[model samples]
Target: MARATVQDVAKTAGVSVGTVSRVLNGSAAVSASSKEKVTGAIRQLNYRPLASARDLRRDRTMRILALAKNLDSPIISEAFRGVGDAAALSGYVSLIAPTAGDLEREQQLVDILRNGSVDGLVMFSPTMPDDDIEALATQLSVVQVCEIADSEAAFGVSIDDRQAAFDITRHLIETGSRRLAMIGHRAARSGRLREEGFREATAKAALLPEQTLFADGDFDFHAGRRLTRELLKMDPLPDAVFCGSDTVAAGCVREITGAGFRVPEDIAVAGFDDSIQAEMCVPELTTIRQPAYEMGRLAFEALFERMTEPGASRRGRTFLPHELVVRDSTKGEAKA
Candidate 1:
């Protein structure tokens, strides 16, 4: 059978070819009734638009690049899945670029992305300075996920990491944990926010001073293990440890068990990002359930919106909710 074309769709829908084209391209200018008719005709005819022709008409590559600090991280993987799924639904190809938390590398990626390499970009945990991101926003439609850009011109989607950390720390304290320790990447913005939250909660509970032990490292399993070992040597070991990521938490759990300490009994461990590793842990991990997938999806949607409507107002910052998931790792609440 001959492939159905836009002309046939327009004829069947009793609309101009332009109207059909608008509908096919997801143009907001098309009316709802006309869109419904065009969609019905497309369904009846099984019409499939040619990508080359559409790209020619739109003057775009229909490609989006997502830059992640660490593509191997489970949270980042979930977010990437969301971005890829959303892009596929919209008939756009999605690509991933690992920045590995290198500012120079991210800047280089941005330079490449700005040379008409892709239609737009999505950044996860970008390490670039706010000024650089703000300047980049002027050149390309960019959306950040899991990290907030300081400029209002740059769009972002993230959970309130500071508040979530505070809540989890409060939970640990309420359950009788006085000496608290934190292990995570301290230089990163997300890590700083989490640490701030932990400090705020501990300070409020009068558990500050020498009671709080802090160790900074890259948010990884090895870092967690190494830091935990150092923490264990403290004059009075912390009874509770709050980790920056689930992977780190898993390492802490392993180290604690190897040291003959029981989770939530002798040393409570709480982690951020409720990734798959959280559930696979021996006693299950108490963690902050960051909506990684949703953040990714929303970030892409924000960028697509800008791409579709150039004159639209900038979407400043979108903050999603974070939940505390209590498991056997902590002695506090059973589940949240």
Candidate 2:
């Protein structure tokens, strides 16, 4: 008779291979019911665990799983590339998986991590809540990239979004833009921070509350166009608009130019994430250059550190630098 393998036991137990491994390794993360089921399967299959095989099962996979909402954005791809590069230096390969804005799918990925498929995980703009992520971090190696939840217990890497937004907003003010408005989404933590920074800059400039308009929508081109149309309908249009992202800013530019308004001269536009779309604009875009690649690299390093030293204290989050790039969209003329 052939020896029963882990897969055979998993099939008989009606559980995942990881779950069976967890049962064999005595991981407490496994559910009571599932543990019982795995044990029953082990006995039924008459599976005898070999000491050497168990040790091999306990070894690291040296693989990292990167979870993102999507990989289409240049900024996101750049960040993932950074992760891959950094992981490569440590003799580990990185793989990306899109969450597609599905919470259930996100949880499944977490389960896969628990199953020991990957040595660690790095999340980009995760949809999971802070508490859930924090809990996961306690049991598994995890790190967050941009758009992280606010939690000291959870390690992450991101630029100072509020400061970046403030710098851009102040630049617009310095370049003689007063009647300001911001088009941002409230779904992400970064958006809210940028909005707060925008508000701060406007209030400090002594712009009246009514002078500082606001619109909430998705961080995309269509949302920018739709929101800009509504903003333009106001009695007095804003002279300057700060979009949440370069994609959104492109939409804003298209709509404003389509309405016979010249950028900067008629309606100055600014955006976050100095993505390729920023340069693709006719007059170019003024935006914040988030250190996405560096953040990605640092995110993996952080996760790797934890994976190698599971008992080490949490290093918390790291804030990378952001640069303000002045372009024709916001700077109509050279400012002294």
Candidate 3:
């Protein structure tokens, strides 16, 4: 029931505790014969080195630090889950810092947590600048999530935002909506990328660039309501509204209804990231499925890679595919 100590390993391996310590710490001074015996004893006894052991062996502590925009956001929470699950599997534990989507707090927390608190960081949806992130990486491992950042700066795992938005916008155009409007948040990388995709697609169609209305807003339900209200007030309301993310679309839908406009009849509305709330909406939001669980799973995996193999040149852009889910909010689809 007790933790296997260095003394226990020494007794089992028939070597001195000092020799066992040397092998655990990867000291070359320990003879090969002694190292083999200690390692074999460790395997047979299933002995795990203590936190103190890492300090003795590597002159450091074993800990993982995870940062997210906020744990309350469903999207960010799932990302933390991925980091935690990966840490557990890798024989490490994670401490989370919920940044509440504040840039200053994100930077301050990064400075605070990147010290001895944790060996490395798994930052989700950070608003910290590129130079700040690049500077942090020199001191410790850093893996970022959700935001489409400088791929050369850090390891990132996220959904294909541009493509996701492009497809959804195209879908709206095909569904009898020529005059389209987009509601999005301009503060973060994902929102910006989706907005870029929307603008690019509309321009390619050459259907009156003015017809594609674009409004900047947060990715929340209120932003959606505000943007939708603005669009409705325009001289000519958009036939369909394409939301950057689902939360915004749902909000827009509420305002649309309040304004006496029928969804999919007078003004169809679509959203992104088919979060659970999407279905809870009155007409079951038509949205993009952003693979929340998978995104979380991979973000941690990327963080693990950064931790175990620092300076791995992990400029990897891992993009998970997204899906278009149509419901009553869009066109009274046969599927939902």
For every candidate in turn, the CA RMSD to the true structure comes to 8.1, 14.7, 9.9
lDDT of 1 by residue, 94-185 (tens): 99999888889888888767788788888888888888888888767998888787877788888988999999999999989999999978
**Against the unseen true structure, what C-alpha lDDT does each candidate score?**
0.85, 0.84, 0.76
Q: How does each model score on TM-score?
A: 0.83, 0.80, 0.78
* Model 1 TM-score on a 0 to 1 scale: 0.83
CA lDDT for candidate 2: 0.84
Residue 134, candidate 2: Cα error in Å is 1.1
- State which candidate has the highest lDDT: 1
Best by TM-score: 1
In model 2, the runs with Cα more than 4 Å from the true position are 1-58, 332-336
Ranking, TM-score, top scorer first: 1, 2, 3
The deviation in Å at residue 188 for candidate 1 is 1.1
Residues 93-190, candidate 3: write the lDDT tens digits: 77888788788877777775556666677777777787777777656677777775674657778888988998888878777788999888788888
Poorly placed runs, candidate 1 (over 4 Å): 1-57
